[model samples]
Target: MKQSKKIAFVAGVASLALLATGCSSSSTAATGAEGSDATLTFMSTEPKSITPQKEPGSQIGMALCANLMEVNSQSQKLEPLAAKSVTSQDAKVWDIELQDGWTFHDGTPVTAHSFAEAWNATATGSNAWQGNGTFVSFKGYEELNPTDGSKASTEKLSGVEVVDETRLRVTLNAPNADFPKLLSTNPTCPMPESAFEDLDAYEQSPVSNGPYKFISWDHNQQVVLEKWDGFKGAEGFSGGADKLVGKIYTAVDAAYTDMTAGNLDMIRNVPATMVDKAKNQLGEQALYEVETASKQQTLQIPEYVEELKSPALRRAISLSIDREAIAASLLKGHAQTSDSLVPPSLGSYVSGSCADCVFDPERAKKILAEDGGFDGTLIIESNSASDQQLVQALTKQIQDNLGIKVQLKPTLGTELSERRNSQKLDGAVFGLWGWSYMSPDQYLSQYETGGDGNTVTGYSNDKVDKLLRAARAEMDEAKAAKLYTEAEAIIVEDLPAIPLFIPTDYGLQSQCAQLNDVQGDLQYYRAGYGC
Candidate 1:
């Protein structure tokens, strides 16, 4: 399924019908932490907290609220933070220890029980299933044990019992290698013991244990957060500096105006369409830019896709997409064309399949003919107004090239996600969406058959299943990459969905703080330096 969406549209529809960009000088600004700056302003597509529905920029909430067990940005390898160490005494039981002394924003000392209760709620799927830790829940503790021929999900977690405060144990059903890594991301991220008291308040008022604390989150206005001085692990805490200050604003021009006028300090997603204007107004000392992560806005063909279900049809549809032209004309040559769903940040599995993603009306016609062209209409769902324009453009192309009837049904955010997840709709022009992480396994768990979070299309293959299983079970990175590599071949050949285009991140900032390379998946807040 296409997990990507298009909230990054340039403007409302009709306006997007003709998007263009202009050249600008390469001005630079202070990115992040250049002068021990304590506070920063961030730009984002969503709030900084997690909720039932979709929100961009919420990943910042996860990062700033609490440090994961591990963050991958370190050069020495996977950097472990909160957990001193993690080792499975046996296939089922894993022992863990807390760092010297860690406390939540409320000054409550973190103990084993904090993680235990959170893990229990996430792994058991007993609660509303925040859609956080479905993988661990589906497999259960048994998925960790390599004992003979045992694969069961029933029965309680007899092995993952707590020994005492500050120390904990885990019991897996099999020798699942992904257990630790999984903890580093989602299932293991400690939840506020206070979150469950009221889910509604939790969404609006989140308490964090990361580098920052919640100041306020007022919808229809900027959300502000101040850094947590008590944060034990971050650099600012060691220096006794005030916690970082974060604010989110929807309008870049306003934010940029404030920045240049010296009312605001920083922003992300610098709108590239008006690059020349941005550079001149902001000046070199206040402007910053970088080629963000190569992320794609692709079509996630739902597994049970009603009308465009055929692999041949999906492949042909891929042919109808003109990524380079779209990138050049609309995106202002800010990004590259991509034919494969996986971007170039990770592995060899990424195939430079641009040639296949070319516009070919004849080929699409052939495939439709072979599949027995249906007279019924086809619908597309999307959120960004620009996507609707693009979808309409593509629809026109398809209809003109091949006598097929098509329709554009654009919708997004909660409505779009519910339809996609509940199977209430047939198709949508999903774009500008993807996982925040750079791992292929992230994609697998999102779309593969039986994947707890799978929505776009229920793609399944015995080989991919086996490969995913093997990759998850193997502790070795080399082995894991190999398995994913093989799995990718299957995905490419199967063509369950169509690869759209790799899109660039855009935003406007007031000229206070500039940043280097912004890419990868983020929940909502943009990360860079502040003045």
Candidate 2:
């Protein structure tokens, strides 16, 4: 799960106040020829921050800080990056050994204390960092993130301990064979000492230990990075470009236009409207597509909503939608109809796991009648920034098939997030659940009682919770996957959310750039761009 940990909000126009008049530096444009000192420009949204923990999966942060582990794009397996080795016996207590000679951009050594202190600051409830949820598995996390909403007793997580200058130990509250895989996520990346001294200033332009060092951030215009000549790490870690430029854009369509015009080196998440024309316009070699395991569009039904509490009603809703048609038509075949909540790219996936997802309008009608017909219009809320055409199609399908009056509420992304966080949503909402790591637990664990990622849908089951716990502790990969599958089976029956579609990630590469490696689930930073 190399994608952003934040809810997969639909890409929308960035704030108008942050908009730049035009792209700066004509030299940054794609040259259509390889140059040793070339600059690669990528289309990107305005980043909220450059801090790894604060903005996990941010391209700027990914380029600025090297993580303890990285996912091999081809194998989809974890590999050591900053860390020399991450080992655990019983999957509970782990030891981490850092690679020698790795130094921060500020020229300070990236010692074990750098990681321990950073984790402590992120875990502290007072800090309220977005990445705090990632540290919940560590021992003594409760003391740092108290549920009572009172001040924490201590800022440090007792589980994180520095063994020496290069070695560190981590003790989780429970066994998790995927702990090392979790380290591959950006939130687990270490921060230098200067970050702790003044977090705000560090966030503006932080010191990091990645292949690229931050050069400048031009607010909403662009972020410039220069290759760190002194970078030392595993082979193939260094980038080909002398400089990388993340050019901020208010809209994806505009980015796609620039990419086709040869002004941009690479652009991801090609707009649904442009999906069909991209390959024809840019040629097949320039358009890249891959099935993504990290995220899926879903219709989340909160249990608190009295009208939608019945499982039969929810199942009927799922059965009503023609996912295949929607995927082919509205999405322009850029998405795959999801049969289960889990995407097919993961190991735990089982085809046709979501039996209710089948499109059978007569069965849906009968089930809806048996479950007692709705008294009022069904409202489907979604972020306006999302794919409204797909939303409109879904609403139309439900209205036509189920014979129920429906309303589509397209709210702003920020306002929608605020309403969701406060549990103030008036009806079922369309959203996405993205994983922090490449594990089934990332998807199934949300069904656990009061789980950290369970903010969208208030779903809970005793059997599912027990199965998830068992999966977490199981060291055997196959056994763990079985336990997770069992949990997913139960969740599918409960129908807390309707799995709509697993989108195929799409990107366009400029004629000047050649992608050495492409990972659909990860941000563009993970790919090697030779320009």
TM-score, predicted candidate 2 vs. hidden true structure: 0.87
Q: Each candidate: how many clashes?
A: 46, 0
Clashing pairs in 2: none
Give lDDT tens digits, candidate 1, residues 151-193: 4344334555667876777765445555555555544556567
Cα lDDT for residue 390, model 2? Answer: 80
- Candidate RMSDs in Å, in order, are 10.7, 8.7
What tens-digit string does per-residue lDDT give for candidate 2 at 1-531?
433222111111221211343322222332324444567889876776777887675777877878887754434445677887877756788888888888999899999999998899877867756567678889979999777878889878999989999999999988877787788777787898888788889888888888789999998799999878677643234445668899987666677778777789887655565677887888888876655546788998888888888899888889999998888877887788999888887778999999999899999999989887776888999877546778899999999998988899998655676576557888899986677676888787667875655666779899988898889888667988898899999999989889999887666777655443423454555445444
Candidate number of the best lDDT? 2
Q: Kindly report which residue stretches of model 2 are placed more than 4 angstroms away from their true locations once superposed.
A: 1-36, 73-76, 271-273, 291-294, 304-307, 376-386, 411-426, 432-436, 450-452, 516-520
